[model samples]
Target: MSTFYDCLLTGTFVFPLLGSLVLALSYGRLSERASATVGVASIGLAALCTLWVGFAFVDQGKAAQTLTLWHWISVGDFQPTVGLMLDGLSMTMLGVITGVGFFIHLFAAWYMRGEEGITRFFCHMNLFVFSMILLVLGDNLLLLYFGWEGVGLCSYLLIGYYYRTPANGWAAFKAFVITRTGDVFLAIGMFLLFTQLGSLNIQTLLARAPEWWSDGGLMPQLTALMLLGGAVGKSAQLPLQTWLADAMAGPTPVSALIHAATMVTAGVYLIARMNGIFLMAPDVLLLVGIVGAVTLVIAGFAALAQTDIKRVLAYSTMSQIGYMFLALGIGAFDAAIFHLMIHAFFKALLFLSAGSVIVCTHHEQDMRKLGGLWKKLPLTYAGFVVGGAALAALPLVTAGFYSKDAILVSALVSGHDVLMLAGLLGALLTSVYTMRLILGTFHGAPKSDHAREAEAGKGLVHGLPLIVLIVMSTAIGAQIHPPLDEVLPPSVHGEGFGVDLVEGVAMIVAVGGVLFALWLFTRQRGLVRRAVADPRGARLWQFWHNAWGFDALYDWLFVRPYRELVRVNRGDWINTICNVAPWLARLSHDGLRRTQTGRLRHYAFSMVLGSTLLLLFLLVG
Candidate 1:
């Protein structure tokens, strides 16, 4: 049984890696069907492995297990092994990555049919799955960092998959650079841990953290702050979150995989996995909640102003991740992981459904240009309604309701009344924007030729994943929360009238947001348009549309100054100094080439001269 478990653990990541290699080696040789089959089957197999291993682990009483494959690094008293850990935390992550990732891969097979570079697409997708699996299952921080950078690389490659577009390239670069900023902080944190504690093994480092640094001490706060830096960056939390909406430049499958299932959730996974270190750093933990609360409100507002369907979902992704961060911040690790899993289901569904809409409408993604698509694309409409309900956290029926309610409840029970209020407000914003997206895209008459002539996708590949995801986006999916009691710090469940009151308020806010949006879009549509056409209203819309002008502010504060510095230093003394060796080498090369004349006399003369010079030097010595 142990050996079988090890094999399953190893196979979960290996299968996708092997598929990636196969697709890469057979690039352009395999048909689209062949590539898709390999990609989908690989992740599907991994997903099966995850389920088997998960159930077996639970059946065996849910104790944490570790499998050491081999020693990875060795130095003076510093050795880290290539090992896998299977606790409830990692098990939950495995299910999310493989389970949701498999569906995304399957949907891509249909969405990417007849597209250029299909083999390359599958190869990158497979590699992404492998990287995310490596990230969540690694036993040590070093191995986890390897997977961390791997996902960043894959995101860049996939985001710029359409290399023909300069904008896509820039978007990919933006995401890579911004995330790297956070990764550097993570790297520094690792360095500090190893220097002070003499280890990078996660479990060891965490167990020793309390002994090394007392609670609320400078060291603990600094380390936790560094970790938070990385988490916020990867999870698309504030200040570093400007890249996500632009990342919609990638194919919809890439968005679903990266934004919905894997990359964005990595931060939540990190914080949750290291709950011990965080428990000691109370200030940093509270800051985590604050960042989350503020970000959710900010992202919700931004989502409200988005015109692009995928961009709207992108902002919503940021908002949803904020909720996870909120859970993490408030010491509700279980709720965070639970929401992470549930968000994976519904967000992936929404993105895939949007992909269906995009493909059917001739790749038009602007909600303003899409309308009357409900009947033409009933499957997609159903997806939108179901997924949007979950996104909006609509009452008790949606999967999001359970997970999200857990977060708000945690905020209230933790005495973070302000954060709880922010959460409710964000919930209202989420519902409003989600309904705006639905009504603006599908409810009105066809807004353009694309929508008017749209055709729904046919095939099991197209419909099966959506059907599965729709089911998962409901209360049925909420019932399958991982047994996290052993892995994460137990959440404080508030009882009595206050808990019920909070839940009631949350429910009302969610339903009310949806209803308000319905009324505004259906009845006060002209009033809304005219108000937006007003000067002040237009500015507010523009401000929110531009994500509160963060990108512009960043350009002014960082990008512009850097560019100016580079321009000013283009020919500085340092450049001249660095160029000296190359300049001399180039001069010597030219002089030597001149001596290499194609004439026998020239060769003989050069040889004689060289001999004479050598003889003179020898005589002098």
Candidate 2:
């Protein structure tokens, strides 16, 4: 039993559960103000405890620390322990989940003011924090899975927080169904690993994978691919990407926390957490890299055509996560995690700031209708600019520049030149769409009557969280590469691939993207209008606007076929069986009804005939 175990059980895991109990007990009895305060305080304490664990692990100078709580399951030789692991990687994730979680809670308190289900909202939020911590801190696959499902449940509840709206329900269902697809693959991958290695303990499996499957074998590749399926599904990669955009039907805070900062990033976290398994199968890594690059390009283009403010950010989240996947796919696990951390800070800030804007605008999300918001909501506009800079990877202006740029650079050094180029193009596209979003919503003249009244509130409820995120986003770049190396096993850093040239090109692309968006939306609106009027240009715009019709293709390939099979079977077998049962029941009922008619003579005659037949049969026998 390591000292880390004691700290985790005593602090990290226990406190949130306790807090949740308190909140649950106080529900309805306490005032809304009190409940919100308690919710924030609980998560705030959890964040502090997580930070303590991070520091303690760093001070101990250990690569990883595991504490076994109990035997989760035992099936003869198959045993999996329920426990926690405090390592450089888990610590990094824990800090982000708890810390950003605290700010999001604070932001939600104000954003959700006077809304129904406020207590329920706090309950779900606390549970989400607990689940996310479990995800990062778990020592084995089983415990990790418990948290995985927990988050899925929380996401569904929160996405449908406004259950009155049919669209919200649909959004929740879509997200659930899509993520469940990934969870299936995750389960299969875990089973394959355990069947092959006979253990689900992450440390043991990682250490033994090389010895057990060192012949460059198929099982490892198959498992890696299966795991990638889960990552793709959870992270909202291609084919599974549509649900995330629709998930914006939920509250804006839910969008900020789940879709942007925490939940959607789980897939990337899963791959990084199991870097050893992926490292063994370079073929799998290459495939992951390709999928990531493709998703990045496609999602960036999708963002370019979106009209809703949250949808644009949703697609941007997918694209940013794709970059992280590309990093992991190229064996830059640390860089991927680093980028994930930095992306969380800025993306959460963007979503939260967007939430404030949406709230003040009376929930009108069409970017085309919003303009000159910068004047009315200067603080939000400032936050938006910082977030946009981060998302665009604009030079040395933000942490995103350092982390995202590093991923592309790492890919080049690892011999994936095509991916590196695609990644760069994706970055450029990210900038174009993000700037389009900022300018269309806040820069141009107000296209709607509501914009003039939109303003940031004077309360600390909104400003304080944005201020904290701004500070963190500015300083986060310096924190990524150092302390991580001390507590986690150092990742395989590739040779620098022409740092100056790559940096120069990335900066140029990012700047060009921003400039182009500004020019098109501001100075060259006439050009955009002319292009949209032309048939050929309109087709191109439409294609991008509909997410390249990936959803349609999926429907044709998977949904239509499945529904057709059901239709055929319903008519051929199911309907036949159902008809027969009902028809036979009707006949039996009619015959019985006939016998029940008021006819005493018929009854007596039938009784006499029955007695005669019985007597004759007995005599013959």
Candidate 3:
């Protein structure tokens, strides 16, 4: 039985990796259908294996298990194993990665049809799945970081899949550099753990952390703060969040995979996985809550001003992740994971549905050019409604309400009143922007020729994934919960505010925001136009539209200064010093060329002369 469990767990990640290898090797040789089949089938098989493992884990009562495949490193007291762990937390991540990833892969078949480099696309996608799986399942920090860096590499490749486009390449580069900054912080934190606690094995380090830092001093605080820095960058929280809106340069499937199932959620997983270390550093944890609150509100406002459909969703992804971070900050780890799972469903649905609309409109993604799509694309329209409602946390019907309400209630019970109010404000902003997105894309008359001639996607490949996701974005999917009580800290539940009052207030705020957006966009659009026409309103819109000028601020602070330094020193003494080795190599090559005469006589003379000199020198010695 143990062997069977081990094989299932191993195969869950291996299948996708194997598929990636086969697709990568067979690039340009395989048919499009063959590539798609391999990509989808690999994740499909992974999903099946995950289901088997998940059911077994739950049925057996959420017992934590570990399988050390082999030793990774051994140097005296420092040894970390190549290990895999199966527990409630990993189980939840497995289900999200494989299950949502499978549907995204399936939908990509239809979305990417007739596009160039189909095999390469599938190769990157499969590799991404494998990396995220390793990240969640690895038992040691070293193995987890291996997967973490692998994910960054795959994200770069996948984001710049359209390599001919310079803008996409830059976007990929930005994401790579920004995320690596965080990875460095994470590496430093790991080094501190190994130096202080003497283990890189996660469970061991976590067990030993309390013994070493039970007093909540500087060392634990510094380590936790460093880990939070890594999380902030990877999760697209404040300051590091400028990369994500540009990340929409990737294909829609890549966005769905990254935003919903894999990359953005990695930080949440890290914090939750290392809850023990964080508990000792109370100040850092509070900072985590502040970061989430600030990021969510900022992202929500930025989302409101987006003209591009995908960009709106991109900012929405950031804001939603902020909610997860908020849950983590307030010690509601289970609520955070629950929301992560729920967000995976609805966000994937939203992205794929948006992809469908993009395809139907001949690649037109500007919401300004889209309208009256509901009648023409009923299935896609239904997907957006359900997915958007879930995103907005619409009352009792959507999965998001249950999960997000859990976070909010946890906040109130934990006595973080300001953060709770920030969450509420974020919820209001979420509803308003989500409604505006829906209305701007589907409600009004056709705004351009693309919308007028838009063709709804056809066949099962297009419809099946959306249908499945729509179901998962509802209350029905909310019923299926991760058995996380044993894995994470239990959610904070007490008597600060009546749970009913909180729910009712949250419900009203959410519905009111949607209604307010409806009236503004639908009934009083002229007033909206007039407001934008005003200079002050226009300036405010532009400010929010540019994501509060973060990109520009970063450009001024880092990019411009670095470029200026390079320009000034382009031909300085440093360049001369750097060129010395190359100059010597060139001189030696010229001298050697003179001796390499293209004649047998010259070669023979040189060899004989060299041999005589060698013999003379040896005799003298």
Each model's TM-score?
Answer: 0.97, 0.90, 0.97
Compute the lDDT of residue 431 as modeled in candidate 1.
Answer: 96
In model 2, state the lDDT of residue 527. 92
Q: What is candidate 2's local distance difference test score?
A: 0.84
| Candidate 3: stretches off by over 4 Å | 495-497, 568-575, 594-601, 615-621
Error of 2 at 489 (Å): 6.3
Better of 2 and 3 by lDDT: 3
Tens-digit per-residue lDDT, 1-621, candidate 2: 356547654476566666667778875687789778878888888887777766676677746667777887788987788788877778788878888888998999999999987877887788877887788788888888888898889889899999998989988998999899989999999999999998888888888999899734798889998888888888888657778888888889889888655788889889988887888888998888888899999999989888999999998998888898898888888888888889988999999989989988877789978888998888888889998998898887688888887887787777788999999999989989998899889987788877867766668988998998887776454365534564334545544447667878998999999998888888898998899889998898889888889878888899899999897787686688779989999999999898876889999998999999999999999
Error of 2 at 149 (Å): 1.0
Instruction: Give one digit per residue, the lDDT tens place, for model 3 in 1-621.
Output: 379988999999999999999998994799999999999999999999999998889788899999888987888977788899989999999999999999999999999999999999999999999999999999999999999999999999989999899999999999999999999999999999888988888888888888877657998999999899889888999868988988999999999999999999999999999998888999999889899999999999999999999999999999999998898999999999999999999999999999999999999999999999999999999999999999999999999999999999998889888888999999999999999999999988999999999998998989999999999999998998988988898987876447778888899988999999999999999999999999999999999999999999999999999999999999999899999999999999999989877999989999999999999999999
The order by descending TM-score is 3, 1, 2
User: Which wins on lDDT, candidate 1 or candidate 2?
Assistant: 1
Q: After best superposition, candidate 3 residue 459: deviation in angstroms?
A: 1.9
lDDT per model vs. reference? 0.93, 0.84, 0.93
How much is 370 displaced in model 3, in angstroms?
1.1
